[model samples]
Target: MESSCPSTPRWNLDRPFLTGRFHQEIKGTSRFASDAKGCPLDSFSSGLENPIGCYDGAVQELIVIDDLLFALVGIEGRYISIKRVHGKADVFSFQVDASMDLALQEIAKRIFPLCESFLLIDEFVESGSQFKNGLVNHALAAALWALLLDYQAMVAQLEHQFRLRRLSIQGLWFCYQPMMGSMQALSTVIKKVSANNYAGSAVLNLLQSQAKAMAGDCAVRSLLEKMTHSASIAYLSILERVISWFILWI
Candidate 1:
């Protein structure tokens, strides 16, 4: 009886996959079998005695998937480093399925904006004396920073899972897709506030409104509520001071 599965082709492992130099070489000829010892597929027919070949093949696929995930999240990994050019948005160093590539691009689009928003706020807090001097702005900035820290932690957790080989590219995408809408909304609000030069209570009020609008998302709502509470501390203190002064006057 013949096996229904197609035979595994021999591949020359002399060149690195990261450089993409092996693509044409693999496609052009079966010359890969010339160096039989270097081929990953050589042991596939060797049966149970050579399990290492199976491991090697699996590792190769994992490496490619891991590299793609790292690129999607704009992180540097062992195999790939994502780069951005001024004229071009993001240039992927490796090629994959066109549909998968497009999906990763869309994920990157949603992610980088939030990253940029966090950087924008950090820069404002760091460089602008006026922003730093205001108590309300300071509190609001701290709250926003806290929220972004949680977001960063979530990404880090995903990276950890990938490293452990517990997550696949599809799993990573599925996990991230649900949160993209809430994150993008936060990014938009932050950018608008930054662009308009909104400060203090104005910023806090907008965030509160945004949080209310996102109430259906429990995780987002909880994060936003915590941020709002932190931001409102200064406002609440001022209100308390006024009430105490009015009581004394009465």
Candidate 2:
């Protein structure tokens, strides 16, 4: 509730962020973002191409909603609905007859679920009261949703492994990587948010529990390392560890 170190500069969401949990945004990596030559693995022979695969259709719809969010952000709730409806003037459909917005629909749908305030293990730690408020606001029902989703995905992968199917574990990587980073930032935020109170202790307990669900920092790193086979775990930064803790949270 009280700002202990208000002077401590927080990230400015108005502009692009270079580091922190928003690193991917800084690099302009969107769901539709492509490789050097422009081939999103989405359309490849991978299972991602399926509109019905693992709720792929739903994911695309969410991506569209995410874009819609940027338009609605910072608008006051008072008359905001009218403002949004009126704000539709500037909206224009990209009429590219090429291979243009083909992926737009899908990407937009994918990011829809994440548009709301997402909690990583650390994002909450930064703003203790706000985080707790969000938790209470959401009714604590989806507390383990992210972790459960990952658990299910991992289980699916294990199933595929057992069936001798060549399914990629990274199919769901996009869903978790940023989630992990965001959670870490939240953890740091929680410490600052709580300052000196029982909120801090409660948050620590919650965070530790979340970390356990995420398989802790070591297990997370191990899993990612094994899957990507990358010696450099770029997403394993401090913010990422906070996220891992959250996913581990039960």
Each candidate's number of clashing pairs is 0, 43
TM, every model: 0.53, 0.25
In model 2, the runs with Cα more than 4 Å from the true position are 1-103, 118-198, 216-250
Residue-wise C-alpha lDDT for candidate 1, range 80-161, written one tens digit per residue: 3222222321112222222223344344344444333443444433322233335676676676656557666876787788
**Per-residue CA lDDT of candidate 2, range 86-127, in tens?**
222111111111222445434433432332223232233233
Regions of model 1 farther than 4 Å from truth: 1-133, 215-219, 245-250
Q: Which predicted model would earn the best lDDT? A: 1
Q: lDDT (CA) for every model shown?
A: 0.51, 0.33
TM-score of 2: 0.25
| Candidate 1 lowest-lDDT run of ten | 24-33
